[model samples]
Target chain A: MNSVLPNRAWTFISLLIAMVFLTLQNNSSAAQFLPNWPWLVMMFWVLTTPHKVNIGSAFIVGLLCDSLLAQPIGLFALLFSLSAYFMTTLSAHYKGLPIIQQSLYIGLFYGLFQLCLDVFSYASKPENSLELNLWPVGLVFVFWGAVQYSLERLSRPAPIE
Target chain B: MFNYGIHERIRIKTALASVSAVLLLILDLHFGMMNQARTYLYSITSPIQMVSAQISLQSKNLHQWLLNQEAQEETQAQLESENRMLKAQLLQFNHLKRENKELRALLSVSPSQFATRYRLAQIISIAQGSGQQVTQINKGSQHSIHAGDAVVDTQGLIGQIQHTSLLNSQVILITDPNQMIPVINQRTGLRGVVQGNIKNLKLRFIPQGSDIKTGDVLLTSGLGQHFPEGYPVATVDHITQHNNSEFLTVYAQPIAQLHQSSYVLILEQGAQ
Candidate 1:
């Protein structure tokens, strides 16, 4: 019964679904201003399931996104790997912080991810580079915190009476 | 201490991976050696994409099922009314079609020259940046979808397919900065290139003497064979002219609901 909760396989599957959902979410008309979900999701997994979402996995996800988006390959991979590394090493500290504070940290890291993407775009297509917006990063991180809280509550094993 | 209970091996591994990612990025950007590898990987990811698509579809269906009975009834009523109106329009449209064919025959022009076939596709995703806009559709090479096929909705041109895999294709929208479509001023038949701008479509290279107004409509001239002729492209919204400059700066709002439509049509050129 204890094994029924989300394990490595379940977590990996969930992350994949989340990544795909996020990809589709970008298609939504109202979600035009949302931050990149795959990056945030990678950071979440790095903090929660480091074994399943290692650096290699992060790079692969980023590479997949780059190809799917038709950008220069490896751009997302590089940024995602950097974010994963940061989250893995610093997530312990983040865990101890309050929810709002954790969101601040997530926003900062997500900003870094966006910054790298913008730099890549500018270099590759100077005329088409997008102006960066940091507000969406904060919004996404706050949403992520809420989602993480809900998942933790749902997945915690029932205590013996 | 350099670490707080974090394993030394993990730290080393992360550093190694980060460096590898940087190397991959440089290789990909400078050499573009990974395009083929990425395309091949899509064959593996298509199944995963299909599963997620089903999940999203089912959830949408579930949401509709959960709607209150009154709301569902009202929606059904609206749809039925809309269907009735469309049926009425269809009869008139058929009459107009016959007249159009007669006129073309009188002019000795073959109607087959203008004939086209379209496949309906669902928009699976849209990636929008400040100056970049790309959309992904569920149809791909499996459905005879090819790169450079024109994509449009009921209203006007949306984009053209940029890349395709087994079951999906990426469309670069008309608003993407990299995208350009040859267009003509429907009013005066003046030819020019409509280029994508971050905010609106720009009709570039038109001489200062060109008679273009704020409300002139633009249609594809079909010069590049990328987009078919006479399809509505945009409506001129703003026109600027410099006293000494040779060209006029004209901006037009796209007539197509580029960012709002959920479904699109992919025109397979020359197909009956």
Candidate 2:
């Protein structure tokens, strides 16, 4: 929550969030509404600084996440890069929309990301079904506004007297 | 780390990144080229995971304590949590009883028969999203927990260790679609393969008129030598066959308590 967080702080924060993500996955009670935190964070960064942090950064971050979380090795890498593609191309349209509508649009895309993941899973094993949970698709978007505000604040230069 | 000033190349770069990621996934899953890197990353992240889990648990307890200060709300929440805890405990008793019997039998068993050793492992985290019913356990390669070691609870077989690091390992649960275990009908001795069906499991490949019946208990047949023989896997719930279909669609409920088990036993066969 510092105004100017250090690099180590950022690394720690990422790891901390990764740790909480494990808890979120294990939380069977609210499985339907669990937002992909790292995806939200990566999306925020991509929208804010499209040129500096783009698809390549998304893929690397996802690779790191995949290793950290003990997922199928490059699973997160694939999901994040694909998401980065969608966000980079679609950011222009959402930029003109209101915050509420913007969140909804992003949520719609998140569902698409989930679909891509499930499709990949189905490819790996034909026994699974393609399930798209639309009920809580946008509900996970409730944190989008907060994520947007935080990233914006963190990126801002300190005000001069 | 990409910081290209040319905006035109961004789309091409994104496509390239996605393609590379897909390649990486295939290489990692099939060839396991990234296991060492994953293990090194685990060293960095697992500690944070343990700390965060503890902090989360503490925060929840504090919130529960605050709620408990009010008399009326206290009993309702208290009883609910207690009920949940009691249910989990009831499930755990099966392991303890089996362990007691097994340990006693091990005393007289020869070295060949005593090839298996059981170690208790704590579930660190479970996979999120659909089609990925995997979990990470606290024990890993250092603990001699090899990949494909059968993971069970007090009741029955749950899963097997899919991958192992120095300090932790990943388990693909029997409920995962990619995970399939060979099981046999305890009563009829009919053999079949059961695929993990997310929350439930489904028996596949059995012929339409196979002598399987509802309520038949399925035990691991150890066909692939993946899981040990004779551990209860699932109980047949029902079988439905479409007209002219060769295979009957069979639904079976898992005998093991799936995700609810906080602790599980890892069977390290031929443990040194």
Candidate 3:
């Protein structure tokens, strides 16, 4: 049990580091290439470890991102938590589906997250032209498809296992 | 022991999650108490921001050096020719200096005072997150750069300092949706608010009958105590009017290339 401490600590540290990098990458890409879909990271985490990456972790990470981006606080936290919960709940029913189907599910959740951001930002400042361009949605779907395909291939169990 | 129904357990968890999310959203929206916490969290990430900014700075410097090498060679040749012409002009101006001074003394008017403007330069780093539309600059609080300092390039005002750490400050550009600038139409003197759009800045709240037209230059009105007075902000790009609306929807193209401005000046105001 004591020997497991280092492994656990390392895992926690790595997760934090990954979260920061993902948050940074998401924002950078949103400004440069596409609006970031951080929900994809939440989806990936949930699909991999449903037990560890729960609603609370999502909430904290979302809050951190909201702060980093100077977004309305708790907006992302709520979005992330809700997205993770919905994804986790949906995963049980869709676990047997093909990779494309799973990707579609993830893509919809990410789209919803983007929608919430657009709505909130627009509602906050009505005069601002917050046009909802579908390009970011398309980018998110493509990213989700790639990530899901890669993860599915990488996580396939061996016959002996 | 007997187990609870799996469906019931899942539903209960789902309900709980929904409730928590609603509660968090309500709290964040109503209270805004998380701002201090957010600032604290941002401070924690400052080190990573500093390192990234340093790397960006070095790369930008190298790129600038290579570009300047050829430009400088041509500029040096031009300057040598221009220097002779300017020297002759200076000689002619000196000849009239005595007559100008006598006129000045007769009018009992002292010479105009000029404030020295310093150019403090910085390199911009990659934005930290996807949602954040801010850039981190190499200067910070330690450099006498404070919050609300106007950042500009050779073209026009780019942004202002949003957050600062020891050696890094985040600039929220004028093109960000959250940013607003008080501006005046340089030609018509029509004052209005300049707002950031996704791609460019737009002039908001000009009355429908306002004399603002295409090709008018917009300068900072300096109404809000935030930015200084009379700096070029943007040029009127497009104007739209609707009969039903009280105000005209005016859009302006920012004079500065916001995405490409690597070096900027942080203006230091003199004591009034």
TM-score of chain A, every prediction, order shown? 0.83, 0.76, 0.75
Worst 10 residues of 3 chain B by lDDT: B110-119
- The per-model lDDT (C-alpha) reads 0.76, 0.75, 0.68
Report chain B TM per candidate: 0.78, 0.70, 0.71
- State residue B153's C-alpha deviation in candidate 3, in Å: 1.6
lDDT of 2 at B254: 95
Top model number, lDDT: 1
- On the 0 to 100 scale, the lDDT of residue A161 in model 2 is 57
User: Pairs clashing in candidate 1?
Assistant: A27-B126
Indicate whether candidate 1 or candidate 3 has the larger lDDT: 1
| Docking level of model 2 | acceptable
Judge candidate 2 at residue B261 and give its lDDT.
84
DockQ values of all predictions: 0.39, 0.41, 0.27
Residue-by-residue lDDT tens digits, candidate 1, B197-271: 755788899999788898999999888778888789999999998998899989999999987787899999655
Model 2 complex DockQ against the native: 0.41
Each candidate's root-mean-square deviation in Å? Answer: 5.4, 6.6, 7.0
Better of 1 and 3 by DockQ: 1
TM-score of each: 0.75, 0.72, 0.66
* Candidate 2 Cα misplacement greater than 4 A, ranges: A6-19, A22-26, A64-76, A85-131, A135-137, A154-161, B1-5, B25-52, B56-116, B188-192, B204-211, B222-224, B240-249
